[model samples]
Target: NDLRMHFVEHSTPSKKNIPVVLCHGFPHTWFSWHRQLPALSNAGCKVLAPDMRGMGETSVPKDISAYDVDTICRDLTGLLDYLEIDKAVFVGLDFGAFAIYDLALRFPERVIAVIGLENPAAPHNPNKPPLAEYREMGADHFLHINYFCEKVGRADDDLLVRIDEFFPKVFWALSGEGNYFDTFKFPKETHYIDALNDPPSLPWNWLNIEEMQVFIESYRKSGFTGGLNWYRSMDIKWEQRKPYENVSSNIPAYFLGSENDVDLKGFHGDDPISLLRKQFPNLRAVEMVSSAGHLVQLEKSEEVNTALVRFIDDIREEL
Candidate 1:
């Protein structure tokens, strides 16, 4: 893919434990796992949180096809190769979860196990192309992914200029305290800003204004193009996975979800965990943190850390 990746790495004193890689999803970066970084390190594991694909300090590709899942998995597996790590347990949040899941499916020998947060599996429907369905969903109402897909430069234009306004609302909107689905109340033609529910003035519990600026500053320079590319390549990713529609992965897997996260509520059908299990037959733990949203890692850091540490402990023998 010829992409330059930037990552934050921490090695435990012994450096004998299996390494851990953290992958972030759209509108997020490696820093998104700030709280979990030390927790994992203190748990006697080496941690590597790479700014996946197009987000953060990583090189952003102009070609949309570059963001497809296959390329993304190549980036991860290649990362492991370069680091001389034969295998590492992967922890992923949001779309990042899909990246690790795909990596495991394609390169199972390279993955020790997987710890998925928020998004449980690589989202796909064998019946129809993903973009077509998103377009259909956006036909009558505002769907953020569809906006990112169809609007093209327009979505980037609107969001890049509104980076300041977008973060707070979008952050709050995706939080357990916020209702992301409420944005659908907006008309089809609505701009993303107007559609977002106004968040309570900054420092709303889980995130403070200072913490929010980290995102604002990063996105202000990076723009939304790279992240949005993930949405645009939805159909490309779907087509790439056509052969494994009914296949199951035996990789050791664990899931951490939130009760109110939008992805949990409706996006992946009624039972995403059950659906995830169908794909990862060796699935071990399923923990759903209460009072958390899509950003469960940030909202419930303690719980998320506990689950991650326990998962690593449970799999230490394998490592």
Candidate 2:
């Protein structure tokens, strides 16, 4: 577990307000928050965007057990200690969102508040382990969760070898215009590559050619094992979280997402926001951008920026 993390940091002059740490989700690096770094830092808040765990410039560990939530949260807490940061406002999306929420729960003393974009609470179901449900969900259709849990390198080889076909289609599939769930219609026998089709040539309204290539080239170099390892660790995380099954956090919280966000629409169960409110009584705002998708931050940068500034401001004022 020898690791080195790369992060983008913006210093703030405010003494009362704490720093803000931006965490990116799967298949993404710190560059995922390129839009937010300037905006949030411009608002007089310190910002740190890290290439979490195995993605981007960060070190990627081959061991599947290393990606568990305890170790992931420990990394963040360790970062805070290294920076001499007493506490900070943590904001995240997708896997990033789950990381920060777990951070708040595990090290409540080190977090001023948390803002989650596109994902609400940690994925939990007290009744049964999550993969059981994910497997059940994928029984009749092709579900990425169940698909990812394949014997070590199955999806990895299918995706990495077909890198040309994977990124654009997956990006578009999770966007407002495309349907991620459509891949589910493919029969179980289909490989992940065949199940995904080509997206209408890049340069969409949200992402440009250069922007998309950054992800493509980076993933190409990194091999995506580290990122996929996050998915591989889910069932393990579920089992480890038994002690916290009924635990809830009252740390101030907020959410930002796209109205058509695939995670909200499919994964988080119905009434996810209501579940959020119950988990965090001080939950303030749940901003959903219209006509946006899973990559809501980049898809509608302006809207996400406005909500982020206000959310950070509210938390800062309280500090």
Candidate 3:
């Protein structure tokens, strides 16, 4: 259904049948996990990373509904079916992580293992605050989530530059300064003054320039609407997930977050280990790597990779 899917396989074939399906989050493509592909592939798992509905080279859907989590998750299942694989270890980061949660719950048998990189939300995470509350936090700071919805047509209109050219700069600015545009191009020695003057930490600054550019190019051509469409479908997602309201995933699960990842700290409002453990009682491992930030796989690949390998290795027989 989606035409933009630019799926990339690893450089080598798997020595075993331990296949893995990796997913990317909003404002990113499968390219986000480029560093981990070869490592995982060499570790005896067939790894496949597809550009989710509208992010990378994936087909862009005209009907925004096509971007809904149910359909997007189904797209991954369809890819597996196309490959004739029964199930695989699924990994997602940020919005990609949310999609994985829905996938595991909706089709438990198809998921061998569930891993979330940064923003991990289980079926139990409370409903997000109302739009009004998020809006009060200010439009510039977090406009990406609700930009496509009807409520903020004004703000959307305000940011109407071509998505391709505009988003990279936006991401660069957000990732660089922390909160939106609080501190763009200022002296580091002036951080205290900068904080007092423009407060958001420029979280994207965690990424190296090259990494940020990769996202910019991918999102620039792909457009963020399809990815952003995930937010619009929240109501449909809620109703769809309601059937599984009582479901608690029995699959081995792991949640990894960076202690210094401002995105997670700013978003979750609690210690990730405590929050995720409480939400997922059967969670096998909850790891926090202090050296890393939002892009755990990119920032601290070895640590993230080691933790991931151990978890899957321990659970392979069950899978």
Candidate 4:
């Protein structure tokens, strides 16, 4: 319950530009936004990227329920309150992007705008089948969601047993150049490690050796249970937010993803831009970076930064 979060802040003395909060996805730290920090900061926005609860230097509770979306959103808002900031723009990727959308939906007043990367703004589908149903449907495919939703400690144990071996394979398979869909053809009973490391593609061009080492070392020290807990709370998050089922984010929102993002295409299997437009009435723009993958920010930092800066500037102009 007492989680001391860690964040990297870049603020100008003038305090002239809009403040931007960057949130990273699972198994990633605030360092995921390392490239965007200076770019956004230099472009005049005050940038804050925090390692969400249970990741990086953040101190979090051991209980799984503590990682729910409501708790995570509170953590971000609490950080803002701690800093005495009123409202700010939010930028996020993957699960981080999902949290930003949740915040906007639940507390639109706290967000001036939102720039989401790789994840879309699809509203909760009340009729969507449960995880167990999805698992049965995905039996032929080695769906990580089903695997993670297993007995609490099962997924965490497997990941800890092969943290080094697991992450690299995941990174490679999910990269733009990787054969991501091929893994689905593997047998249902295939172990995640074996499926992840199968005929691996080394030296992922998007991520260099040093970058890979940073993530590997960070997970090695922190372990993967905290991160996995976020996945465990997916169903709970949906259930808890039932009151807000019909709500949609009314704030200015933009989505930037990659054409090669497997999650965008393979997992969701819906046109993100179209669905996002439906979910967010005030959505400003939807962009897809070519030759980029799930880690679009890291793979095409220049383009991503450019789009982000433009979005912030445009939002500022409107205000």
Candidate 5:
């Protein structure tokens, strides 16, 4: 399964400035970072944001194995190779954050530093059970992980059939004031669509109509399978990561999250920044953007941009 990634690049006046690679998570594309591109470029930093293997304009592989973490890292490293970039600072969100952590661990020399938004760095845990067992353990509940992995094509079909309706609710449900966690109170037999739409409000202020249309149109053309494949590959990634069980990323790292991020408590039920620091000793800073949510970069672009520029400047000075 060959995948050619599409990326947007912004260059600064100084060619010597280290490039920063931005990676978007599920149901997002390179366009997700548009707000920060100009700001980073104006700050004298070269920025490149790519639509990872199976999402956006990138080639989507039919085989689930191709979406594994190792393959995704290879796709990214290969992108750097194609661009003739020897090294770069990696910035990512959600699924992209997971990929950045993997890249930093597997190829530290190629990474100057890592900046993760929303998601934290999780070191390999040998004691943790396989994804399947974990899914079984949570079978009584309606977890997105269980739904996506178990249902697979059916899940994709359901979402795709109701793409327009599904995207808006999911996006809004994950936003700052969405109160998405409350959906969990529903019975375990509740359908994902029904549960996800709980307390759904119209006209998400965080994302404008134009922005919402862009996402809807993109998903309309590409379908959800490409993005869902990333979820399907989780078990394979777990099995493949066995060799790196004791490994931890030693690269310079920083994490930023929204103060209102639902996933912060909904998913892990722990302080992500604290867990991140425990996993990454060189983690330089942890900041939370007030009144922001899972999509912090877009929801609070100015704050995210300022923090990123500051981090870039500090790292550049150290170099």
Candidate 6:
């Protein structure tokens, strides 16, 4: 479990230590935010972006339970302690966004600010449709929640190929038909076809053929079990944090989803903007990209960068 802590630090030796920790979600490495690192560092923030557990070059833990939010968040907390940082801004996407949510909720004392990409506030169970509805719609990805929560052992043993295959499918599925299968022939990334098609988007930007080869090679060498363990640990995390369901993030926050992105539509629910307003009472701003997909960081780097810089400036003026 100690292995998943890979980090890339960018600091310009500034007087005010605006330490910011960025977290990447599933199917992405620290490479997801490659465009933002230099910009943040130039802006005078000490930035640390890490490939989370089971991700790029990070140590993959053998125990599935280690990847739960509590344990994973502790891994980051321990990472901060190791780096001697008392607190920092937390920026995250997808699963990373979920972890950030948990971080701000479970350890608000340690967070300076939080920004979530794509992930909105926690779901209001009453307004949420039954899981069966999504299943009936033939999107089984969320169904993995049930497997992760209840059928860990069975899923652990059986779903390796499926996960590997479907992982890439999420990218195209979320993008809708216009981009479907088009993401398949992106040069040498043919091998991770399923993954490229799945969650996260465009290997060409963050990962070159060589990089992907390295990842696939490492995966074979390391075995997929450790990475898969993360799925099995979710139920444990829910029980641990069940008492804090009503908690809201007061840290200055931003929620940006791609307006053209279909993948985030369902998750965004009926009123995405209003949902964010309810969840983030102190939410500083909300923006959506009309032409981009779920991979807003990559597709709309300029806007994302502007929004991020603006958020930091707002806080600086407040201070």
Top of the candidates by lDDT? 1
Q: In model 6, where do residues sit more than 4 Å from their true spots?
A: 1-4, 124-227
Question: For candidate 5, what is the TM-score?
Answer: 0.92
Off by over 4 Å in 5: 123-130, 133-137, 198-203, 269-271
Runs of candidate 3 exceeding 4 Å displacement: 1-4, 122-133, 136-143, 148-211, 269-279, 317-319
- Model 4: worst 10 consecutive residues (lDDT sum): 197-206
User: Which ranking of candidates, highest TM-score first?
Assistant: 1, 2, 4, 5, 3, 6
TM-score comparison, 4 vs 6, better candidate: 4
lDDT of 4 by residue, 182-265 (tens): 767777666677777443544655667788788878877787778877877777787776776666666899989898988888
Candidate 1 lDDT over 1-319, as tens digits, reads: 5879999997667857679999999889888999999999999888999998888999999889998878999899888988899999999888898888888888899899999998876457789998888778778888888777778899999998888899999988899998888888888778888899888998877888888999889888788899999888888889887876787889899998888898767678666787789889999999889999999888988999999999999999765
Q: Compared to the true structure, candidate 3 yields what TM-score?
A: 0.78
Query: What is the C-alpha lDDT profile of model 5 across 231-257, one tens digit per residue?
Result: 888778887777765666668898888
The window of 10 residues in a row where model 1 has the poorest summed lDDT is 263-272
Error of 1 at 37 (Å): 0.4
Q: TM-score for all predictions?
A: 0.97, 0.95, 0.78, 0.93, 0.92, 0.76
- Candidate 5: clashing pairs of residues: none
Where does candidate 4 clash, by residue pair?
none
lDDT of each: 0.87, 0.85, 0.66, 0.81, 0.81, 0.66
For 1-319, candidate 6 gives per-residue lDDT tens digits of 3544779998899778588888987556787788899888888788999878876678877676677777777877887898998988888887788788788878887888888888776454543333333345334232333433344455444444454454346444544233543333443212233324434544644234454444445444445555556545645665666676666767777777777665466545677656666656898877776777777776678888887777777776654
Residue-level lDDT for 122 in candidate 3: 37
Better of 3 and 5 by lDDT: 5
Error of 4 at 244 (Å): 2.1
| Candidate 2 per-residue lDDT over residues 97-155, each given as its tens digit | 98988888788999989999999864578788787887888898887877777646877
Candidate 6 local Cα displacement, residue 5, angstroms: 1.4
